[model samples]
Target: MVIPPPVRPPRITEFLKPYVLKMHFTNKYVHAQVIHSPTPTVTASVSSQEKALRSSMGITRDVAAVAKIGKILGERLLIKDIPAVTVFLKRDQKYHGKIKAVIDSMIKAGVKLL
Candidate 1:
């Protein structure tokens, strides 16, 4: 018999920080948000599934679509006065492919990634 390894949760510090950016990607869509930790509120959120964004791209699962969502998210964050953030990537996620595209687009949109 094989025993499954234990699962470790994300650090509490991630939720205690001032501004943290969390991203989620699935087979059909990508979503991102800037969360205010102290208040535990989402300051801004963007997803490829949004009507405006989906209508513009016509596809929600590609890397380009993820980049577009990131751009929009960054713009929204800037509008809300959040200029920089610490990224919180899930343990199963890597900083490549679609994730890289999103982060690059956010930087291009003027949001600093800490």
Candidate 2:
């Protein structure tokens, strides 16, 4: 019997080394950190999944949701003394429409995806 090779998780460091990575999920959450580092050391992050925001804006397929996540992420990053990051859109999704809108918004708000 033949067996398949073990699947490897997407490595963020492989793409953006020596810099902070701001990875946003399709869900309401955004996770930011330096690659190959521990979770507690996350540079910044945010999510509409938070209690207050979740009640006002339940999960929905609207550009506003993505934008809000971006804004929240930007604010958190600012507070953490991180002024910029390399936006790593996880899972190989194309950058268009809602994602593009959110990314643009982040740039405007000072995320600086590069």
Tell me the deviation in Å of residue 54 in model 1: 1.4
Please report the candidate that would top lDDT against the real structure: 1
Please report, as a residue range, the 10-residue window in candidate 1 with the lowest summed lDDT.
10-19
Per-residue accuracy of model 2 over 13-113 as CA lDDT, tens digit each: 55544445555555545433333243335655555556777777756446777777677767766676666665556677688966776677777788665
RMSD of each: 10.5, 9.9
Cand. 2 Cα-lDDT: 0.62
**In candidate 1, which residue ranges exceed 4 Å CA deviation?**
1-16
Clashing pairs in 2: none
What lDDT does candidate 1 reach at residue 71? Answer: 88
lDDT of each: 0.86, 0.62
Task: List the candidates' TM-scores in order.
Answer: 0.83, 0.62
Backbone N/Cα/C clashes per model = 0, 0
Over the stretch 43-78, how does candidate 1's per-residue lDDT look in tens digits? 899987777777789779898888888888888988
* Residues forming the 10-long window of minimal summed lDDT in candidate 2: 31-40
